[model samples]
Target: MELAISIIVGFMILGAIYAIHARDILSAVIAGGIVGYSLVICFLLLKAPDLAIVQIVVETITLIIMVAVVLDSSRVEAYGKFDRPAWVTAGTAVLILAILFWFLKEASAPLAPFGENSMRMADAYVNGAVEKTGSINLVTGVVFDFRGYDTLGEATVLVTAVLGVLTILRIKGKR
Candidate 1:
């Protein structure tokens, strides 16, 4: 599992590098999506399906917006002079992101192995949540009943983001 995560992180690193140096906006957006989706895989492997689902949905929405913006405007290369300060800033940001990811991995190391959970509450939720909530699916029961308000907020945010993207695209189409 460690090997798998390392490989995925390696790919993410490559994607980030490509995104930073990509000549065209579209290729950069695609490379950025690679990094985001790679994060979803890492979250899944770490036994955090909730985080994985959130990451996947957010990443998908972001990728869609980025692609739409790129396609709607310009096909030209995104760089202008590519100065030394830009390189330094990009490098610093990547370094910060890498350090944060390292801390996250270290912090989660003591938790259960990949695809396994150490929490007793998880078992209780899985076993009896459906019966209590009267939902056919365990996931539905947990999300809609147990975590109702939280789920509602997340859904609202997603809907708002998508609607914003659609509005932007529609406005661009009129011109």
Candidate 2:
């Protein structure tokens, strides 16, 4: 399971890199979707079904919005030009790689093994959720009652992103 998760994470990183470096806008958008789907898989592997579902839905909507934007744009694809010198770019990449490697190495040591459910917060939520929020479903209660503001903020952000994308596409249509 750990190996599977590691492979998925590797693919996620690859997708992110591809999205950033892709010459074509359409390819970049597709790569971004790949990264988002990979995250959903990661959430499932971590035993968070609710998070996985939410991620899948968000990813699907994001992909649709991005594709709509791309299709409505005048250019089918656009390539970005790097103005920095090759050596400077290479040095920056190397530095970033080194920092990432160090951080991964330090963070890879697991605090708890898989299937371990010893968290105090989990116990508290499981025990008190129903009484506190008057909801039979603990997850739903926690999300809607305990952390309702956070959920609302997330929804707001999603709506803002969709509106921004629609505004850009609409402005492009005028031109």
lDDT of 2 by residue, 50-131 (tens): 8998889988998998889888785345556789988999999999999999998889665566667557788777876777
Q: What local lDDT does model 2 show for residue 113?
A: 68
Off by over 4 Å in 1: 36-65, 77-116, 159-175
- Alpha-carbon lDDT of model 2: 0.86
Q: What is the lDDT of residue 106 in candidate 1?
A: 95
TM, every model: 0.58, 0.68
Clashes of 1: 0
Off by over 4 Å in 2: 74-84, 96-119, 152-175
Q: Superposing every Cα of model 1 onto the true structure, what RMSD results? A: 5.6
lDDT of 1 at 167: 93
